[model samples]
Target: MKRLIPLILETLDRGLTRVNPLVAAALWHLRHPTRRGVLKACAALPLLFVLYVLVLIPFTPGIGDIRKAKIEQPARILSADGKLLAEFKPSNREWVKLKDISPNVVNALIATEDHRFYQHFGLDWRRTASAALHTFSGDRQGGSTITQQLARNLYPDEIGRAPTLTRKLKEAITAFKIEALYTKDEILETYLNTVPFLYNAYGIEMAARTYFDKSASELNVLESATLAGMLKGNSYYNPVLNPERALQRRNTVLAQMVKFGKLTPAAYQTLSKKPLRIDFERQTEPPGPAPHFAQQLRKWLAAWADRNDYNLYSDGLVVRTTIDSRLQTMATQAVILQGNQLQGIANAAWGSRAGCSNGKDLLATFLRETPDYRAAKDTGLSDDDALKRVSANRGLVQSVCESKTRVQADFLAMDPRNGQIRAWVGSRDFSQDPFDHVQQARRQPGSTFKPFVYAAAFEAGAKPSDTLLDQPVEIQLAGGEVWRPGDEDEPSERPITLRDGLAYSRNRITAQLMQTVGPNKVARLARAMGVRDSPLEAVPSLALGTSPVTLKEMVSAYGTIANLGGYVEPVMVTRIEDRNGEVLADFAPTPPQQELSADAA
Candidate 1:
């Protein structure tokens, strides 16, 4: 038993010896580190330090030159000898260097945007830390250095940030690269050019030109301050929306300039003495009469740019328009007064009336409610309600509605000899909404159709004094459609002269004349007379202008008639050139075609 006990104790002693060596080996590994591991830690610490100091520490500005081609927009509306009517700057985006952006303007930007601009590197660590602390506390804050902003501005897609560590790291790397490449002045210049000023208004140059009607170099201190103040919040400080607040913000920028030593104390005092009291309402030039001309000019310029494969907004192009200012004024006024009055008379007869017999009271109501009625929407009212409104005041509403008492006028004047549109007014007010009626809207011509009908009759061998039956008649069509034509003032049968028929706008006589001349002959005559879209089947009622036609076609046809049958295609553009004075195109007169006899035309 004793020998067995001794064997057991020896086996246990060997097991304990083996366990101690293994435990010692594990303890040695826990206490000691590898040289490779130590070397890696040393390398990583300096790498992080270097990244903070060299890359993340400094703010860098942006740099890139615009690769834009310069072209000249076409000069539309020209005189016989190629004299210009109006000059246009359609989508003109010129890059004026920062040097030209007055020193006051630069100072204003620096004062309001970055007071400690010169002292900070690519990133202002203190401001960054403050922003971080604020953000951590659920407060919104931004203190991006100019360089970081420049990076974001230059590479919009790449530098889009969401206040994440990854974005910050990327910003730091890009900022360092930008700073290394671009000079401070170049950075500032790029920043100003790329920064957004208003809705779709990118760059300080565009803002200056758009708001002040001047170049950046021509801006005064007040204007500079006002522009600089917009960088923070363009919509919030819009001069058009919040003039008082905008002025106050601008003055604050000026004050900051004085505090930052960018402005002389005396200069600041003078500039800050009073706000630039710009009367938003009255501080504008009266718009000229070439609204339609201007609109067409823009369209042509856009098409020209597209044809040349150029960016209209980015390409710096100077466009000249063809608007005879004097003629435009005359034509616009004529159309406004004469057209409105004619429309009024038409309204008095055909419009819905409340069954009132008094014409004076009806006209009064028309005059009173015309503006509102024109401004109101055409939809949402049921047919019954509309009729009720039209019938109110015993036919007053109906009478007023008949004559076009509301504002709707279109004027188009062109040289019949050359087809150069000299003057045009699309609507009475371009400021209201520039839906150009001159070229866009097609309205019923009423008696205006008589001229073409008469010309057709003359071409068909009917003389000016030819007699036509003015008796009431019913027109029957092959499709079984029946239409009874009547005169406005006469109910009894009568005979009328061709000239008198047109002068009186008699429906029955004109309808009979159409039938005698043949519908095909009249259609052919209408087309040859410059009616771009010819009237449907010389319908019996076409003589009364039941058809729709554009002002351009009407004016073109009328001008041809006045000029004795000579027809020319209207030319809105006269010349096109490049910024370097190179001619691109010069408009030539389209040959005149004789469409009607001398007496007929």
Candidate 2:
């Protein structure tokens, strides 16, 4: 039995030696029964395991190519003041160099994320040992160095984020490779440029802009510490969404910075007392005074990019337009105020209508067409029950289409001298209706077309003082139909001066003048004045502005008169530039075409 036991020990020792020499030595000592030899072998085990890890690191896949990692940057649109109006970050990333980042942010990141960031060679052994002890004791803590986090970010598919020993070993191997390939500053730059902050913000630059409406370089100590705290749990520590939690986390980061000696205790106390002042009003999406203009710019840029072999979403081009932001704001406010007033007037008229006597029935019909009503019905409510529920909401009935009470208006202010569109408001509310009414909707200009007819008469050698008969006129049409054109409310038989007829928008006098100058001449002059989108028929009704014309066309035609009879095509965008500030194109004003004599206009 003694011989069999020794032989069994010898066979076990042989198997252990192939795997671990120190373990085999410990097993051999157990056979000899020496306490000293077993203790010595036990002491060598950790050193032997570390050596084994060091030997296996070079064989890891993609370890040698750490320096060749690439970062994707999204395209950004900036206003004239360099304010970010919009960003097309499909990957939600923007790369900012380490040099561009504030030192306060750097120090905060190191203190919160990795206290021994500078002291470590990719892996902090002391932190790793402490983390190991804590993990075994069922306490959760992380010991990943900044470089290790960077490695996982760069090669997530290769070095997974799974909290397993295998993943940890792979991560350690990749981190060592990154540290060997890049300098400390380079690693930090890559890490800051690659780490996700929250939401769609994927880097320090975007995080800075998203949270503070400022560049990463301009981050203060408090701001830096706040951002650093977000690394722990972004949603839980979001400065805008969870201010109290974020403030606590930020103070914790400040304490960490002080504990690590990155910040003085006095400085930490001062910063910690400060409030979490975040700019919540600054829009992270395409928001500004000119959302319609921004959308127009995006479409134009997309076509231009396709023709030029560029990417509108990834090339980071800077498009400069002629829109004046201040003017745009004023114009938008004016349109909204005027539209609401007009809507109120129309609603008052609607409320007095005989058809509105069936108010309850109309409200029910309107509510039935709404999505909210449908949603309530889908939740097991009957049709009548859903209608009753929707009707109980007072606001829903108030918004019903009482003769389409939602009045929309389009306003455009242009620089008449150069045809530059200074301000443009396409609708009362762009969010509710994205249709650009100014450039798209065709509506009759009513009496506004009188100016064009008068200008044609003046060009035909008729002076403003020339008298025209303001009487009802009956004329023959092309399809053998008789047409009678008259002024609004009543037809005047008095012979009025051309100036009086145009000023009063007298339709009878305009028709008489149109007959004298010839309808074809009037239509030709309207075309010359930049009314080119729709065709104008030479019928008698043309004198009273019966033709459908876009607001843009009317603005351009009127702008010609303001420009002293020169037709300059309206332009919105002035230039485009690449990311490196290289101008790709510069747009000059389209040369004006003289359409009328100044006196005639």
Candidate 3:
């Protein structure tokens, strides 16, 4: 009765004559003794919430300034004549204007992804309320508009969350902020540039160029529809994976476009019926006379990528190699034909003996397991370990036995003045065994060593026409190894001029001359003649091609002579550009430096 008397007094004080009990309670509170405390709590609650919103839980700038994204400079492959050979890949996000994109495309995206894009101030409250109702009713529909998508792609993790009330409030604030900050077209453009289209493929520019080998501006109605359809589920509707699903998705976009009046019904029907035609022309490899050059270039690129910390497959850096395409082609064909001829001769010569045939078959079988068909079995080698176990002399004998083709061939050609690799053949064929015999292989120089020996002699005051005897002679070595040197002309001892010694590649004459001119002196001369590896010491058989030499060193020596004793270091890349169109590296061929006397070399 006292409480009721107090409530009646409070209701009377608030002048609530016809108040219901609930209204009476509100009136009582309005006039109650603790009203000041209740009002203060209400005011403080909103202030604390505002402080939380403004201070700690405000919108964050995600992903930093996108303009600072790192880019690999696209590699530009060029011909010897400086013509563009090929571009490694076209760039993603090469922008196109809204006018350039089909109106239907723009309409379809708006209708499907964000219907109220034009009308809203970056956010729609009515839709937000409906989304809240839908979420409570167990339907989780994302109300992200095209602008929201762009904001997210350019800066994900901002408005995208579990659709909490606080997050929704923040998203609305941020979306409004973005709308105020950027224009409608600007937002749309950003969306086009950052959207992912397919697996490992990003942006509409790359999508258009990759799928149709065309530009976004060049996308026809059907093609635009296809691209639009990819947005629903890029991997699922990818034309490359399931064309039927892609076509159906595309038709859906087209139908939406017609319903929106962006595309006429007639236009949609025509586009839907047209064949999906695209020229899937694979990128052409540079034409080269020396395919071995390509193999070497590939190896060099692999190493370069490792050194430069680039993923060759994923990092979008373009690599340009120094190769004359015409020369590469010539070199490849020459090796292929030569390998075939030699392989035929080897098979025929060893065909009569069952043991040799079996060995050859074993080699052939091993080679067939590889990509190279030219790695025909060499019956001359007893086993894989035989070459390692035997002396060089025995190895030479085995090489000769296997030399039915007597045609061991290896070559290296480079631009003498600039050091650009023009042609290199490792083993007459890359597809045969694919072992890069040129760069990573060592082989006997045969008579090729004589030129270096003679160059040494000439540098030591011997003339080209100097006298030397090409007679057969047995000589005792200082190291107790005895050697008998002979010329192919053979048998009778004959006096031949040093000119003839070099021209005919006579062994005895060169050996006898080595005796006259000490072996150490000859080795020094070989070093001067471009033998980069340590020169072999003078020995009894030094004149008979005992030391091994790489094709690079051999060719450098030959080219030094060809260039009138001028030597130039080889270079491959002319320049490397960064993605932002900045020159990261620029290379120019330097003039030749003199390494040897023209007269001696």
Using TM-score as the measure, the top candidate is 1
When sorted by lDDT, best at the front, the candidate numbers are 2, 1, 3
Could you give me the TM-score of model 2 versus the true structure? 0.55
Q: Which portions of model 2 miss their true places by more than 4 Å?
A: 1-286, 352-403, 476-482, 518-520, 535-538
Better of 2 and 3 by TM-score: 2
Index of the highest-lDDT prediction = 2
Encode model 1's per-residue lDDT on 28-132: one tens digit a residue: 443455887678768899788777656633332233321121122333334334444444433234456888887777888888777666776677788889988
TM-score of each: 0.58, 0.55, 0.49
lDDT of 2 at 578: 82
For every candidate structure, what is the RMSD over all alpha carbons to the true structure, in angstroms?
A: 13.0, 13.4, 14.6
lDDT tens digits, residue span 1-601, model 2? 9899889898998888999989998786688866877788899999988987877675565643564454343456655455455555555566778889999999999988998888889999999999999999999888999988888887787766678886888888888888887889999998888788776787888888889889999999999999999998888998888999999999999999899888899987788899899864332444457877777777777888889987676566787778776777789999999998887776676574322322456656767788889899999999888887877775665555543346789998888778888878889988787899888888888789888889998987899898976677887888999878765567666789999988887877887887787778888999999898888987777888899998888888998999889998888778888888899988888778999889987
lDDT of each: 0.69, 0.81, 0.65
